[model samples]
Target chain A: MVGPHHAIKWLVFALCLTIGSAHAADPEALDREIDQLKSDVAALSQTLFDIEESVLHPADTQVAVFLALKDKEGLELDSIELYLDGSPVSSHLYTDRERESLRQGGIQRLYIGNLPHGGHQLKAVLTARSANERFIRREVRHQFRKRPGESRIQMTLDASAPDYEPVVSFQEWK
Target chain B: MQGLNNRMTFKRWALAVLFSAAGVSAYAQTGHPELDRGLAQFALGAGNGALALRYTQNAETEQDYLLRAKALLKTGGQSEAVRLLDALIEGDYYRGEAAFLKSSLVSNDQEERRRLLQIAAQKGHGEVKQQASYQLAEMARTNGRPDTAGKILASMDTGYWAALGYMNIAADYGSRDLNPSRALISLRVAMAMAEEDPNKERGEALKAQLLVRAGLLAYESEDYDKAITFLEKVRLDSYSTPQGLYLHGLALTGKGKHRDAMQSWHRAKKYPLAFSGVAESWLGTGRGYDLTGYLGQAGEAFLSASATYESERVTLRKLADMVREKGAYAALLADAGETRAEWFLADSRMLTQPRSAYLLRFMENAGNQAAVHRVKELDSMLARMERQEHTLKVLTSVLDERLANSASDNKPALGHVRTEIESISARLIAARQNATPGSSSVETIRHLAQTLKDLETSTDRFDKRLHKRDQRLRVLHQKASDALEKLDHRKRKATDVLRKANAALDQKFLAYIDQESERMLVALERAEQQIAHLYEYLALQNLGGGSQ
Candidate 1:
């Protein structure tokens, strides 16, 4: 049996030791937890950014031109040259598959590019062989406005005219 | 004595005239015996063999040999005809005509045909040359080289045959090339040539046919005004077929004359022909109805047409069955080589039956669906895979970029840093555990506690950030998964709708057939009963006739 004052002093010393050990453990454990959390956050952010990049396009102004031939008869297409404001943008000598696809009523994407929003001119020169085996050249020019968003120009080979020669016409898709 | 001398001179002159006339008649007979024999056999309506024999027997000229070859060909002696034509071609006087005739006999060799036609056109005389040129132009038109045909026709002499050739070329261009304007030009030239030709009745008939053809071509080319003009010029009395009437209606419809168009269709339907069904379908679909959006009237019209076809088919089948039951009649028809009539009857019955026609149309629809169903299914599956793949690719890139950034930062990897921090923690714990209550300074304890508190606060902040990002990621993953589920649901629903629609169509077709078959059976029973009663009455009358 001990005296009351001596017992209280012993209790206080025990409590202090327990508190000191607890404090010592807390910092090291917290540091490890924080390092893990930081790593996780960085990884998640990167994942989110990559997802956005893949699914979304970068903000830009662009114009696309599509070409098609309707009633492509009596005309054997050889090549097509696309021009933007009097400057050549795309020149393609048609491959067999491409020509066949066009003849089968497939649309070809002639050009796609970023352009400042304003009025623009497009010109396309078509070269083909006629039924008489003579080389025929035709050119079509069209004026269009490129708005803030994407603009589409469609070039059609219309051969329903009286002469049965392919008539190239450009129309803006609204 | 002078009167007697005058009488004798008159008698002598009469005798001389009589002998001269007899000699002239004899010369006419022997001089062109081949022509006379050919004409006589033709007049008697003799068979080709008899005509050929006569011409061959009397072959004294190049013309006679040509006529014999023509007769041989008519008699189906193609080899003998070709041999005779070869012989005739060796003679310069008959070469062109012989070559022209041979061209008609040959088949399956376009080059040879063209060469022969060219030779005939270039060297044949008079009408034969013109006819050969016409044939060459026609051949070119048939070969899908309309421009060549046009050129050939243009080079021909101005005549009725040339005009006919132009008309044929115009018809070819109209039907094949779908160039009505060019066709119209050709027609105008043909019409002018016909007007100038001496055969008035034939020229008028040709003009009428050309006008009708021009109208149809104009309608096809969507030149409705021109079509109306040309169609109006067509004499309805002789040139108006059901097809013509329908085309006229179409032109009228194009010109905004709806009432007139309806009149034309009604007139067309009155013909009771195959095209009448088509006209009815068009009228039902076009007038006062949206064909695409509202299919009720169109369906009714199609059902009606189908019923008509089914009835016709059943009637023909019954007739064929009746004919088969009469074996004697069938054998007689077979022996006569008239089995084509039986076949035609059978075909007519099948096609005209409404139930059969409906089933045919339904089967056609089913076939079309089957053709595209697999393609659609595959496309749906591919799209789903593409979406999933894209999501995974994005996730992979995100992870890759994070790793790259970490490496480029020249900082320790998260795992390594974690290990370092843990090691530091262990060392600190060891140090804390080793601390002697009397030896450790208060300052060292306080600094250690502050560092611990700071790390805890930083760790709490980092954990909050991580929790936020993790929640975002979970939401995105859920969204992608939900989108995939929705797409799958949509695909299933679309497939179900297609299946149900097809099933409904099949059910309708079956119901129609059952109803039509029942009605036909009832009618057949009534007809059999009536026939049996009539036969009994006739037998009784025949038995009682002598006593009465």
Candidate 2:
């Protein structure tokens, strides 16, 4: 360690064109503390993520809605709004990054919240820019029975062959 | 800042360019939608690799294997990913993608990587083909076979990828063919392509590299004005800026603006010596001082640079020792305080690590940054595992308390749900006694109640939500069908991910980071040599000037 005495000696060189590498010299004694926590962190991250989810929304009543835009070539999704049981729960304006990811078959979890067990209506309202350069608005609603223990519904927006009009369809995962 | 400019994939480039709408949807729908969802999670990068990997463990079809391979690419190592892709190499389905991904996985094996890349370039559709061609051409150009690279480059798409092709051509002309004028022209074309790219950050980085190359070429040709024009346009934050500054200073010296030249060289010297032009910048700085008649200061500056490089050599040795003993984490956390699995607290926590400023230049390699992020993620996962273990312990005690209180205390929570379960069971029993067709219902009830009872003795007893028998009965009726089993699966899956991440850290990340550190040490040694030469020159100059 350079104390006050030797510090002055450093500047006696007249010109110092140097970006000095200075830090508290990390020694070997403390290496174990971090090494013990290594690889353990990735597991803890996943655990905490799962723990946080379970704590916030237990699996028994958890309802997660996902969105997928599979028809990347025919339609450009500008924005989409989702409603659970007739109340707006999620809305997203698609960035080019997200949109392209979706085109490559990436499904996004749009909303994850609790729902009491029973039947509910999921309404999707979206405006997409189609090939004609016109903003086409579409509204679709589906009735779904929310089974106990983590109901995951993936709503896929696609364009049917020939006509290429936008269509929104829903699939539930076990 | 820009994370990985040089290695921007075709898909990354498309992130900014607004598409001019296609006629039809090109997405191929797989029968299993769950795999698509997993693919989505994989696309997000980090933290979700486990989720994607675990969910797709039982991948069957060619498509499934490919998706699982993609998940493994992020979460696991190269060998398993290669094994998975090997299945689809002969199959018609996803042959191109599988080949391209395999090429990426086996990138260390040059022969195999080129072979796979060639396959992908020939058979792959869309972005994969363009990217494979780009890689193949880049490799060929790097190997000094510009003619072969140019032939291969013709197959690549002429959008944003054209910029990279021109970059390869410029590289070829500059070094391989020794055609300065052709190299400058190629670089100009590359810069023009950068302008057309909608990805502004990537464009800036592309142009920066091109400008530096052109500046150097122009300066070498003694076209000081042309060099000045190209170098001045470089973005200050670009990775190539130090190199640009070095050449710009040289161009200024060519034009006899010694003071302005000194300022540029001084700015360049502020960068890490490991950077491409920083060593030359040090010599330039010393020369600028000599040119300006500060002979003593010139000697001092050279001496300072020499001492710094020699000290850097010592630091590199220490860094290597640190890595060997403590792994890459210690050196990375040199600037960090209280750094035990803390990067998980925030994804970007590693940004402030590595107290040595020059270490960041090594980390700027996309591969190194990814490895660092992976290490931090592993730390986060480990921390979470501890939390879960604690949670499991708490749940155990709570279950014990619930059992202890079961004899006397009966706090009615969700009583109606319990009554509903009791009523359903009673009705089922009555139907069974009367010999009715209710076998499945009766058996499911028995299965649920028995499983919950058995798990009561296990470490991971159900949470407080199922504390009371009535609540247990309610949950048993509601989720006991698969809840207990899935919870167990999840705990096991987390362990698997941790094991995989640990192996990956050792297999891929640790070795790569060490290699990068060694590379930095080599660069530092080169810088040291340049400084020594400059110091000798300056000392002689001072002596001659003093004699005059």
- For residue B527, model 2's alpha carbon misses the true position, in angstroms, by 14
lDDT of 2 at B494: 50
Q: Local distance difference test, per candidate?
A: 0.56, 0.63
Q: Model 1, stretches more than 4 Å misplaced?
A: A1-174, B1-48, B125-127, B142-145, B157-164, B171-179, B191-209, B275-310, B313-548
The fnat scores of all predictions, in order, read 0.01, 0.11
Predicted complexes: DockQ each = 0.01, 0.08
DockQ of 2: 0.08
Candidate 2 residue lDDT tens string, B264-324: 9888877665566776777677678878978677767666765665665566567666655
DockQ of model 1 vs. true complex: 0.01
Residue B259 lDDT (model 1):
64
Model 2: what TM-score for its first chain? 0.75
Indicate the TM-score of model 2. 0.57
TM-score against truth, every candidate: 0.37, 0.57
Error of 1 at B28 (Å): 20
